[model samples]
Target: MRRLLVGLIVAVLTVTGLLALRAELMTVEVEQPEGSYTEVLVAADVVRENADVRAEMTHGLVSTCRLLVNADVVEQSFRAVGDGVFAFRLRPGLDEFDRRELRGCLSDLRVQHLRVHVRHLQTVTPADDDRRRDGTPAAGRR
Candidate 1:
């Protein structure tokens, strides 16, 4: 009985050690706040698709942009602009701050070949009483 208990403890310790070795986790702090926002248009390119390059780049950029901008994806299209060229329209929760963060993030993006590159960043100001795709008034003033 004592041997069985010792074996169980060893197994538990092994599992715990493996868990500790896993990827680091992001530390969550205060919730992302929302404020007046402008639409941000971003462009990138996928020079190649061999070895799932397109899919990998799309997922990676979307993830990083989300982290930096705290924006909702208004729209995204792969190869919509041209072959291997991608476009994304993000509506950030915060106005100027998110815009700066997104621009900064895109500027910081870099890789050697077949890498996602932020070719453009544009801030689109909506007219008063702007409507969404569903034709309803956007979050701010109506």
Candidate 2:
């Protein structure tokens, strides 16, 4: 009987030790162009304690422009210029394009060393009265 109890305690200790070895985890809030948000799991190392990240998409004359910031995303906004390139305020002590270019296409934006998978969107003109006739509020119209 004593041997059985010892074996059970050893098994429990092994399980507890394994669980404690797991890496730190982090949660990410992803905001899409349509103003929808989703929570994603990421490594704790991706986001620092005070690091800021900001990303937004704007509809332009020809195509959509994606404005993103790595250091202070929450504090920056990009102007939607009629042309292809966008214009943003250069923060104090920060140069233009201080953020890294997200590679592997805009749909797959990897930020803060985390893989952020974004959905591609179809740009519907705001002047399309017929589209809003269905009573569904247009995205970002409000």
Candidate 3:
């Protein structure tokens, strides 16, 4: 019995030491890519409609825009800015062609009472100071 107890204590101490060493030496590194996106504001009567129906319309709009622009929609970037106004954030800032195409697509949604009279386009880019020594934006900066 004494021998068994000694062996068990040795095993427990070995495991505890191994765990402590692992805790001291383990390192975690996460790398995030830097990129730009565009902020767009859409104004239409459908956006200000009943809250329940408005959610459905917003989802449809986001899906439609994703298909039409061939761009990734920034996650959790859709929100209502004001009465009859909603905003969307699209990855990789839209160019001139994209802007024109987006405007045309929104106009085509007239049947849903979506009349986009105000389109606010803004580009988000990392500042110079945020760049790494190699001149690219640091990881997770975007």
Candidate 4:
């Protein structure tokens, strides 16, 4: 009876291992696109209470750029939207792999140690969208 139980356990473990291997091999791998494939622009503003913290935040963004090799990740891509206010963007849509890579890289960037207040976050229309003069997206646009 003990031998039979052991054989059953071994058989179950072997089957589980084989299934895991097959699933891993079957996953579709997408190569990073040479050009824009997806895009999600985020508008944000960094809190301006102290210059020292602000500089530190800017410095930290360089690490974000380095960790993720994409040149389009936002850094100084901000513009004046109002008095004492500015707008920034966080470009997305690289792919699931890039996002996952960025998430992992952010952990190493030590963002938890930084203090920057980003408020009034909103998603802007994608650049790929061509809008008409009336503020509606152009026809037959992706």
Report the number of the highest-TM-score candidate: 3
Candidate 4 has its poorest 10 consecutive residues by lDDT at: 36-45
TM-score of 4: 0.37
| lDDT (10s digit) by residue, model 2, range 57-125 | 221110221334232212333443322233332122111121112212232433334233322222233
Best of the candidates, lDDT: 3
Sliding window of 10 residues with minimal summed lDDT for model 3 = 24-33
| Candidate 3 TM-score versus the reference | 0.54
Put down candidate 4 lDDT per residue, 24-86, tens digits, no spaces: 444343454233333222222244345445444544553464346363546565544443344
- Candidate 1, residue 90: how far the Cα is off, in Å: 1.5
- Give candidate 1's root-mean-square deviation (CA, Å): 13.0
C-alpha lDDT of all candidate models, in order: 0.52, 0.30, 0.63, 0.45
**In candidate 2, which residue ranges exceed 4 Å CA deviation?**
1-51, 54-104, 108-114, 126-129, 134-142
Per-model TM-score, in order, reads 0.44, 0.22, 0.54, 0.37
Judging by lDDT, tell me the better candidate of 2 and 4: 4
Model 1 per-residue lDDT tens digits across residues 1-142:
9999999999999998877654223223323334333433344554544644655565566667667656666654323465555566555444544555555555454432335555655544343235555587555411
In angstroms, the error of model 1 at 70 is 1.5
**Best first by lDDT, ranked:** 3, 1, 4, 2
Candidate 1 — which residues are off by over 4 angstroms?
1-52, 75-79, 109-114, 128-142
